[model samples]
Target: MVNIGSLVGAGGPNRGQASYATSKVAIASITTVMAMELADHDIRCNVIHPGAIDTPILAAFADESEDESSERTIDGVGLQIDT
Candidate 1:
């Protein structure tokens, strides 16, 4: 089982994103449990945290300045645009 998680799981909470952060934490915990329990069956469970990808949802939550800063930060990290 592959789960999509967030860096927020380790970074903790952000303003107005309590639920989002909590869900990511839960995903990690669930993935861990699934991995342990399914190991006997040779099934693998894992979660991936893709940090700070540019998306419409990101802009919806951030103010103009924050959005610009995020863009710069993501660019600085050399994130590739697949499309």
Candidate 2:
């Protein structure tokens, strides 16, 4: 299983996003548990926490230059998984 999360779920905080953050955190926790429980069956589960990217979705909310978006994307955290 692959799950997509946000950096805010890991530690970062966003004002007025408590619910969104909480849900993502729960997803991370559930992914961990699933990975552990399914290991015996040779199933792998991982979660990805992505930072701001230069996507149309983000463009709709924030007007960022291409350079700025690229910087944020590159500076985002990489993939991580715990066995």
| Per-residue accuracy of model 2 over 1-83 as CA lDDT, tens digit each | 89998877676555546898899899889999999999999999999987756566545434432465433533444422121
Please give the TM-score that candidate 2 achieves against the real structure. Answer: 0.63
* CA error at residue 81 for candidate 2, angstroms: 31
Please give the CA lDDT of all the candidate structures.
0.73, 0.69
Query: What lDDT does candidate 2 reach at residue 18?
Result: 80
CA RMSD, predictions in order: 4.5, 8.9
Q: How close is every model to the real structure, measured as TM-score?
A: 0.68, 0.63
lDDT accuracy of residue 26 in candidate 1: 96
User: Candidate 1: deviation at residue 38, Å?
Assistant: 0.8
lDDT of 1 by residue, 1-83 (tens): 89999887755655556898899999989999999999999999999987876677555433343555555644554654443
